[model samples]
Target: MNGDWLIRGRDGRLSVYQLSGDAVLCRSERGRGGAWTAPRTVGGEQKLHPVLGIGQGIDGYAHLVSWRPMTNGESGLVHSAHFRPHLGALDWNPVGHPRGQGRRTGAPAVAVDAQGRAHVFVPGEDGTVSLLAQKEKGGWEPWRELKGSSVQDCLAAATGESGRVELYATVPDGILHWRQQEPGAQPVLQEALQTQVRPGTLYALATSADSTTVFYTDVSGDLCAWRPGDEPAVVVASAGPGPVSAVRCDIDGHDCTLLAQRSASGRVAFAAYPTELESAGAWWTESGPQLSLDATVSLTTDDNGRVVAATSSPSTGQLLLTARKDEPGLALEAWRQV
Candidate 1:
């Protein structure tokens, strides 16, 4: 899955969503410190792409979006929302083609505003980014185009603590950005940034109420972090060729950022640093046995406020999860396959 595979609900329970055939399967923790339930299919079957985009709102609803093959040889985006923890998700709702009949060329990215409205961003074949957003009261507005060119598929979206949404995408030259001037307003295009990054590796994390930090692998296989208005990107650490997953948590009474990625050797590598303080440095530590290269890692804080990391077993397809130990620093428990 290209998007989020692990999600923490408002009730402190965690749910794991994975792609199985054309359907989306989910397994949730029964309760805090409880065993995870068996994998059960949630969203109905469809001709879905390998990508899955998940965004959660302050109301604890998880919005899901993916592309399905259309009859006209184009791709259409479908959506579903998960509200209750144990209950099943809503049926897949068609968001239609971003350009009416035009095809979606890349994976869709989702971000939920502070009001719990979902905004879906899709890239069209013409290199333009289209947005289909949920209205405040209910319903959805017509698809609108956000002007851009040569926009690559590495689209990232994050809603700031102020309830405004920000978007970033990779262009041939550098990076394109869009931000909402205020909550519930449309995102206006900002100045394009000059930086070379690998496509499909963009990930955004809202660091504060008004600021967001974006992380991605550079062309040289080094992980970097850049916030708006930052002149040069800060190199975080050397990483593999895949996307990275990160979450902010308190470590040893200090606010820190934890990152995980699949290394070139196929093992899960982890690193932690003081949040927004990359100059302090970080070191990559391998955790868990090596799996398939396609296997992705996800991170979230558990009910007890401990950092948890999860991935799927390539051979058994079982959900493998581990949590940070109660000790000091970034120690973790052994991998538990459920």
Candidate 2:
């Protein structure tokens, strides 16, 4: 999802937003671990998972988008919802609709610019990528093709200076492409990057004026990175062999990164980068637990520097946890079920 947030509750608890079944849920850190705010039906229809975003503007509005299935159980449309944490309720009753029915191959990818304008991306029924945007001043633009075919079902976004958003996705051939989008400016597609970003791999992005970096796992689950125009990707963590989860968040007013990859033994390969992330292996200096989480997990951090993860499994139930900062950070607080 596009928005990265500093969601602090009244008691200073941290919250992670997620979608369960067809509803929007907010799980917050409690005494030792956390508790779930009641599930709220933000979107009337959805299947699989929805992307989440919390605006950076003064409104602090939060957003969600999901693939709405048709009567035949196929994804035919995209639906979106809005919420405000200050009000503790959904502020908008209307769902934002994409311009048309879609094959819904990819989940909605969203990002909020410095100005609080939200940008959304999704794969269309015709094998092209669709782009939608909401203005910071208000109102949504009609959906339009951003161009591409054989695109995979994953998308990522990063906002840089000058209101530009860099959107990236992997095509079937294991190559990645990115484009720079600015409001009312001519968009230019960049040359394809040979990131070797495998199909079905979860990826995260980090951007700055100087460079933009993509982080993901290879087919064998070794962590990797691609820095456009600078150099070829380097393997950050050798094949841990499982699902990858990552997020850029803030702790104590500074940027922090959280990364997790499940190992072959069902234990999670997790690390926290307190400074700008460079060599990830060094953060593994402390020892901790081996664990597993659903591949579609999103990570966040509390003001306390504790990592909070929202994850799910069809058989084991959905989970939310705060990584123990003291005990080598491998030890998890008791997880609350979603």
Candidate 3:
């Protein structure tokens, strides 16, 4: 759908919201979400894959990935959705299934390159990670399994300037590994020893505009940074929540922004970590305006770092999208809208 949607408790009660030319309308089950205006139906009776994406492409179109549900009644499979704004209205269509190679596919990460092609990564059931590339001719190249250790948590990154694509994942060995695919170099596995990022903790990994520096959250609840040429990782900020919900590195220079889900308070907050003094181990910092979220949140940052989209429980609060405008080394200007 052209609008936003939220899914609750898995009773198959999916809520679809449509931003009409006028106002935002929501549609869901009569008993589930109460009687509301019948918004346009987006997905059919099929269950949503548990993830969604909406963003502009290099060709000015919109690329989306509504992850598909698992076949074994678990969690696997991802459905690709594309929206092409040709004349007046948006034409929405499905692209491909974001699956690896084996009998398992879940936790799909998607990114669009400068060529408008989609690059997706889905960790397999065997702990191996795979990559899928979609060409402009509407065909998918053979699934390519990356040469890395078994990764449990995996995410995708794409550089707008270099068209460089990378996959970041946490291996079972508690090591953070990444695979960078570029024009000349083969897919190589590089470890980040500086961050001390271990397993069992949520780590948000991002890269800078130059595609050399790596940013992520460490187990100590601090924003840590590392460069491809650096020997050790350095702490950028210690005030970040120990349980970060979402993190985006490489925002507005080499800064990293994180959306932390405070479990004790169940509130979502934002913080920024900018490393200016590379050798002196100094980094700029900023705090968000604060979002007192009543429900649990699942967070993700957009490519531009201007907005952070989060899904919350209905009984707690309405779904919201926080637009945060960063002022370099100053506090962030944040506004919440449903």
lDDT of each: 0.83, 0.53, 0.45
C-alpha lDDT (0 to 100) for residue 90 of candidate 3 = 26
Stretches of candidate 1 off by over 4 Å are 313-316
What local lDDT score does residue 247 receive in model 2, on the 0 to 100 scale? 59
TM-score of each: 0.96, 0.74, 0.61
lDDT of 2 by residue, 257-278 (tens): 6566555555445565643446
Give the 10-residue window scoring lowest on summed lDDT in candidate 1. 230-239
Which stretches of candidate 2 lie above 4 Å from their native place? 1-13, 29-38, 43-59, 71-83, 86-99, 161-163, 181-187, 207-209, 238-243, 247-256, 272-296, 304-306, 324-338
How many clashes in each structure? 0, 6, 3
> Which one wins by TM-score: 1 or 2?
1
- Candidate 2: residue 240 Cα off by (Å): 4.6
Model 3, range 197-216, lDDT digits (tens) per residue?
Answer: 54434333334465544445
Clashing pairs in 1: none
Predicted model with the maximum lDDT: 1
- The candidates, ranked best first by lDDT, are 1, 2, 3
Give the per-residue lDDT digits (tens) of candidate 1, residues 1-338: 54567988878889988877676788898987688888876776666876788888988889999888777778778999999767888888888887676565788888999889999988777788989899999889888899788898779998887888889999988888899997777799988888789888888888876688888887877788888877545556556888899999999999898999888888899999888888888888999887776688899997678999998743457677899999997888998787
Candidate 2: RMSD over Cα atoms?
4.7
